[model samples]
Target: MFWDLLVLVFYFIIVFYFGFHFAKTNQKEEDFYLAKKEIHWFFLLLSLVATETSSLTFLSIPSLSFKGDYRFLEIALGYLIGRTIVALYLLPSYFSGNTISVYEYVGNRFGKSPQKTLSLVFTVSRLLGDGIRLYVSSLPIAFLLERMGLNLSPEILGMIALTILSIVTIIYSVVGGFRAIVFTDVLQWFIYIFGGIFALGLLVDKLDISIWEGIKNLQTSQKLNLFVFDYLPSGDNSYFILFALIGGAFISIGSHGTDLMLVQRVIATKNLASGQKILIGSGIVVLVQFILFLCIGSLLYLFYSGQTMAPDKVFSQFIVAEVPSPLLGILVAAILASAMSTLSSTINSLSLTWARDWGMDRWFSPRTLSLFFGLTLFISSLVPYFLIQTWEKGILEMGLTIFSYTLGPSIAVFFLAKGKAELPVSGLVFSVFFLTSILSTVAIGLGFQISFTLLIPIGFGIQIFLVQISRLAFKKN
Candidate 1:
């Protein structure tokens, strides 16, 4: 136990070393976020990959394959399409202004009222989505603590886990700023990817099955099924190929094109060409990443001999029971790497969004910006304590589903801001925003039968449709 923890401590030590070492001192807001400095495109590509990938990708992708198949890649396919579209359209707006918050582009195009409105919606959605991610990362940590004979309730374990993860993430983020976040991001990305490969190799040695034999077994069990060609929404978050492709595309566009945390890295690149490269490249990188982790899930299913368990629990239990010490600590560190990279990004992004969008920067220094959001994030991370078990979906799905509510409307508005037509804004902004929120409430909260994948596309469509109608209404009047 001691040796395992030591490995984790050493990893964090390196993270801190790089964080403060590269962190800009006497920094203004531009230096703190993504202004004035030139980061290489490769680092920007990896930073984009690391920030959005989160614990949900690390743990949930494998869990998806363990229970189902490679159908999740259908979403990846949509991601590629979505990103290509963003590179073509939305990114021009991102670069057109010296926009601090990406929403500033909206303020430039529409009005400040519209800008702050969308930013507020993003904050609520981001906190809730990232809160679930914090919970997912804690699953393994809670499992590890239990293995070490910590006789605590799951909620208490969650709190302990949240505290440990948030503190380390907050300090470097607050002290080092975005530069530190990106540098550590490159490091964390390598660590977690190695961790995935390590687990895959371990499974290979243990299974002791021929590649041909394993492939045959996978075929027989339908575990290699990659496409779901259904026509209608299954109402259960099931991915029909079309639903997956379309919904995934919209989700990617909304997330990568509109969300500040994901898009900022792309915008910080050296030029428009570099921005497009990283944005599109990240989608491809993430698709490959999904394949790697999903394959791990397949191997795990074989290792466990097809026993049914909760998707989230399957991998966590395996890490606790089978993984040896020091190695065990390293694996835990890998999970922390995924979780912390994102939490750090969240605190910084939240700080940027709040300070820039809502006029908070006038009253708050850059460090104070990080400090406030970091504390808010720490408290938010514990929200899933008792409620986690009540979730019907895996952590990854839940995280995406929650964000789709607002992400859909957000991307829709971005395009609306870009269009040639002048739309009526007096009530249109709140109209689409509240309508999407209420629809999400009714669908998921009341257990309606819409594919979670379709939430973004559906919401985006609804908002765009309404804005057009409002535009026509003004012309008629």
Candidate 2:
């Protein structure tokens, strides 16, 4: 216990050091958000992966394959194609000018109303999405706390984990800004990947069965199935294929393409070519990473045959049960750090977007900006804590559902590239898009049979359609 606590404390010390270390580099406002140092494509690649994945991934992916098959690989395929499209098409548009955030492009294309509106939308939506992600990502660390025999209820443990993540993230993010976020992202990516691989190796060693026997287990259980493009019956247009590929692509287009948090990273590269490399490259890295985690899940199913466990609980309990103390500290640190990586990214990006795009930097220092957004981030994250039970599909789907909400309209806003719409008109278009998205998500939550994935296209289509119609309706007026 002493060694684990020591290592965890020691690891956080390094994290704080990074925050302070980068604090020196941020002399200017832009430096705080978009560092003056040149970042390599490789750094951005790793950061993209780290920013995109979180503790929920560590907890839920294996659980995904443990209970079901690897149809997620189908979604992974869409993610890959989506990134490629973003790299080739969307990124070029974002890189044409030195915009700090994508909403600048929105402002330039539409007007201040659209720009400020989208930035506010990004902040609000990310408040929900990243807030949920931060909460779920805390689960594994909270599970570790439970194993340590803390005399606490589950709710208290959850808050402890969330506070640990948020504070650590805020410490570095508020001090060092985006540079620290990117560098820590790279470091945390290595840490968590090693933790994951170690878990897989440990599991493989624990299983006494031969390769053939393992194959037999997978075959007998029918867990190896992938690529199910199941369409809903009775002319249900919201099919898995539709959701998995088309919906996946649109979500990716919106997320990687339009969302300022990630797009901030993409355009941070040295050149257009470098930006393209990292954007497309991250998709491959993530696909392989998903296969690794899903394999861990399938392996866990074989290890605990005939045992019933909640999908999200599979990896956490295994770690508490299987991993020894010395390495336990490192893995625990890794899990918490993975969550911190994303949380920190959210904090920095949100603050920078607020400071620059919303013109808050005019009055606030970078540190002040980070602090304001970081505190708001922690507050927003708390909103989902009590709502966790309602998301029955567990953390992974909940996180994705949150992404689908504002992301679709955000993409739809980006697609308004050709003409200048009036501020009121743009606002109305955005309102309609977001309204449709909110209604669709609520209907799904109320047990509507439609796929939640359609929220992306619905938002995208609604905004684009309404804007086009307005353009036509007012063409001669």
Say which candidate scores most in lDDT: 1
Q: What TM-score quantifies how close candidate 1 is to the native fold?
A: 0.93
Give the runs in model 1 whose Cα sits over 4 Å from its true position.
Answer: 230-237, 386-400, 427-447
Relative to the true structure, how large is the alpha-carbon lDDT of every model?
0.81, 0.78
- The regions of model 2 sitting more than 4 angstroms off are 229-239, 383-400, 418-448, 475-477
TM-score of each predicted structure versus truth: 0.93, 0.91
The best candidate by TM-score is: 1
* Pairs that clash in candidate 2: none
RMSD of 2: 2.9
lDDT of 1 by residue, 115-183 (tens): 787787778777778877787787787777777788888778778878888878888898888888898
